[model samples]
Target: MPRFAANLSMMYTEHDFLDRFAAAAKDGFQAVEYLFPYDHPAAEIRKRLDDNGLTQALFNAPPGDWGAGERGIAALPGRETEFRTEFAKALEYAAVLGNDRVHVMAGIVPADADHARCRSIYLENLAYASASAASHGITVLIEPINTRDMPGYFLNRQDEGQTICRQVGAANLKVQFDCYHCQIVEGDIAKKLERDFAGIGHIQIAGVPERHEPDIGELNYPYLFDVIDRLGYTGWIGCEYRPRGGTSEGLGWIKPWLKR
Candidate 1:
């Protein structure tokens, strides 16, 4: 059976960030993931997870001046020092949060920026991240965000992410396969999963067009769940989506899976 983790970042907006841990556990989620834990102390976040019996499945490294519209700095030149500093902080939190996966976002670049230069910087940053994280038994992840939602984002395809992982050549480095992004950029979801399963570190899902509950989207999640099972993917499937109504009210779609 495919295990699902509630994405506290997007789901359970009805409660405070810390309080969302219990909300997700109450909803039968055994694990939880969020965008960034820097706002709260790692000890506080760990306490919430321990209190709710929930595992911290995944989270992103600091994405450099989010308020300034910078999504990430891993791909940006002259930001290597900043990226390493922020990524080390992420690993420190992961040590306390007990999560094995840390996603390093590829920052947006200028339309006229040199693509080759960006790729070189990205690969170097990823190599550093993977090597540093491996010492602590942690895996670093790279995700391909859809251009429609995140224009100018450096990475935009599964193959591109996988190829980067190969170039980085670290056992602990892998791709974060997000179904929502894949459906938008490439329609052959199942085949892609099968083809790229070897390099996938984690998986995420949401409605294709609206980024809502998985069941609310065009993709048949139930069928895809079966496909994931057949593919032998033993990783958490992050419920990274917004609720159309109350978060819990829209959780009926996951009840059956939770029971299993």
Candidate 2:
């Protein structure tokens, strides 16, 4: 069976951020993930995780100016300095939180921007991040987000993400395979999972059309879970989705998996 990590950023909205750790543990989640941990001190977050007996599965490095709508700066030219500083902060949090995976978001591409230049910058930044994170036993991740939700986002296809991962040529650099985004951009989900299994470092799932619970959508999560199991994947699958109703109330879909 696949291990599921409750996404604190999208799930458990009813509880305070710190309290969500206990809430997830109570509901039988052994691990948890979130977007960023900059708001609270690393010690505080670590305390919550240790207290709740939960493992920190994954989290994103600081995207540039999240409040101002800047997603990430790794792909943007001339922002290497900021990216390095922010990534260092992320690594610090990862050290305290005990998570090996750190996702690096590729920023939005301007309508008239030079595609080649952006790719060059992205490759260079990823190489830098991979090398820095390697010393701490952390893996850097790049996710291919769908254009529908994140218009103009630089990375969008599974092949593109994997190809970039190869080009970067860093063993610690891998792609974050998000099923919701993949379903939106490309339909051949199972085949893609099988073909790109080697380069994938982490996975996330949500409903199609609406980013809700895995069982609430058109895709048959059970089948996909079987496929994942058949492929011998042992990583945590992040429940990165919004709840249509209460977070815990809508967790019926995952209860069966949690038992294992």
Candidate 3:
């Protein structure tokens, strides 16, 4: 039915992390995603979800050196140990929330880290993560972030992500397609989704240019949602946009879509 989701992290300074979910609940959202929940125990996060009947849609793997601008280390050499450890921690939280997928965040590529080397490291880690998550029935997702937002970031396109998913060769390893990023890095989001739908395990969104409410922006979400609905896409459509104010103030933009 093309269920919608709000990403908790996008609330940023506009709303308290938890208040976003609460407002989302009131705004008729029943699912949500988070970039990182490692700081919050799985038990408490799950309690929030249970208390509000909100399904925890997805969360990113532990981000390394985030303050220094490092997002992930999944593709770094000799860091398989760090990747796996953080991935395990992510799985622990996923289990607690019964989340179906966890995004295996790809880190920046060092000046010396070539595609062959980074691809090898990323796929190797994916193979390990896919197998581990399979036992828990949780899929591991790899999202392609735009280089504009992430300089030197690895896995910035659908083709690359899909190819690595093939290399990983595990049922649990799939693409975490973000429409916002793809629209920025590679346009024609619907066409790309059609081409790589099989590898896609999840979806996220934000308006282009201005990452605000869906209606106040360039992306025609109704059309996007319609296409996804017709294509039998069952994954959560995560709203990972920057709000103009507290969630409620700017959320009236999506009021039309809130109807259940």
Over the stretch 24-62, how does candidate 1's per-residue lDDT look in tens digits? 999889999999999999999999999999999999999
Task: Please give the CA lDDT of all the candidate structures.
Answer: 0.95, 0.95, 0.83
Clashing pairs in 2: none
Candidate 2 residue runs with Cα over 4 Å from true position: none
lDDT by residue for model 3 over 1-260, one digit each (tens)? 57888888885446667656676787788898888987777788888888888998898888788888888888888788888898899888888988888888889987776778888888888899899999999998999999888889988999989988987789888998888889889799889988998889998888886777677667788788888888889878888888877766777756666664
Q: lDDT rank, highest first?
A: 1, 2, 3
Model 1 alpha-carbon drift over 4 Å, by segment: none
TM-score for each predicted model, relative to the true structure: 0.99, 0.99, 0.94
Total colliding residue pairs, candidate 1: 0
